[model samples]
Target: MMKFFSPDMKCSALVILMINSFCVFSQIPHKFLYVVGCFENGTTEVQYEYDAEEMLYMDFDRDEVVYTVPTFLVDDPSKLFENLHIYLDAKKAKRSCKAIVVLCKEEEEDPTEESDPPESIIYPSEEVELGVENSLICFVNHFYPPEIKVTWTRNGLPVSEGASLSRYYPNNDQTFHQLSTLTFTPREGDIYSCTVEHMALDRPQTRIWEPDFSHDSSVGPDVYCGVGLAVGLLGVAAGTFLIVKGHHGR
Candidate 1:
């Protein structure tokens, strides 16, 4: 006569004892039976189990041990252990390993196909002072599944030093984005590129950026202004020549 008690509940001792008694004689084989009662939107799980070592019925969950049967009531504990071993072997043969089940609100759908390739952009740091330490940023966005490989190169040679990649972040529409930056000093004619590889792309996507002295702010605006002045002078000279020739003919 095994006694069962709810370790957390004193008043539930009688209920646990009755349930354990029912479980002992229940025709359903313990090994094949799995009674899982879920509550609170599946956050709470209650599992009923049969313990072969103590030859007792038990119930437990994540928080605390719910109930256990006392040993005195179980007759022929050795026979119970034998039956449990046989049941375990049969279960292993049937499932081969653990099995999992997931419930979702939506209907189950097939696995997604490969998504579109990621969009990439490369740009130098805004501070354009020459001979200063700066970084080239590679922004890759709007990619699915979040797994990607980013690489950097300078002048067609692989650049590993001073290169870093940020963790993937989720986008508003459920896509993903990541950034890779390469730190380097700006120099004339240095070409840098960032390459991105993903499962959706047959070939790697690369974006290139280079420092151009012609586009330097200190010189670029002055050159454009000088060219505009020179054009204006030419136009004035042509107008004066035409007027003087008309006066001489008159």
Candidate 2:
């Protein structure tokens, strides 16, 4: 079991992130089952994994356990009986996670440990086309403590209309990663930026993006002109050949 407290928090009742694992060797292929939970901002997320693949997760929005692999029982006979209790266990885990967060209160601010600032990048989901709707993705990864903030700006102005943030996902290195997305139509001369704020950094990290259709959009016209010039030269050559042949015959 591994436990991670909310980074960047000094309050008495802070966020709790926990991951628990179980191994089964009854079959030829060994299997690993794990549960991960994060309690924060009056919300809880609990996920179940089998052999490093997600099997189920608690949906806080719908207040139900959603199965990532729908045919869980059909896929694994060993899990047929365990499947019945998995949902109940997830619910229990969620309750216990919340209780721990409430009970584990920090009387004073704990000293900040060495933190890892997130590496961030911003890019469009698809090739940018002027006047076409697209999404801008800001990916942040390899940050410790799992508490970070991401914000977006367009041409130096703050934007929030079509922006969304994803829940923190654990990486193999025990760090975390997250994504923020913004939807908008690409236009000429439009610049976008994604900024990340974390405790590890003295200053926020920012990544900028702008539509560069100069190369992609210009290929069509350039090809057309080149082809047209080649065809015109070929026509002139053919006409000269016919005229020379007529003069020679006369």
Each model's TM-score? 0.44, 0.65
lDDT of 1 at 238: 20
The best candidate in terms of lDDT: 2
Residue-by-residue lDDT tens digits, candidate 2, 1-250: 2233443333322433333444465544533444444343445555555455555666767766666565645575335446477556666766775666555443324533435688987767666678999888787877766679999999999999999997666665545677788999998898999999998889999999888777676655654454454334333222100000011111
User: Candidate 2 — which residues are off by over 4 angstroms?
Assistant: 1-27, 36-44, 70-83, 98-114, 216-250
Tell me the TM-score of model 1: 0.44
Tens-digit lDDT string for candidate 1 (23-46): 448786443222222211222222
User: Number of backbone collisions per candidate, in order?
Assistant: 3, 0
Model 1 residue-pair collision total: 3
Off by over 4 Å in 1: 1-109, 112-114, 215-250
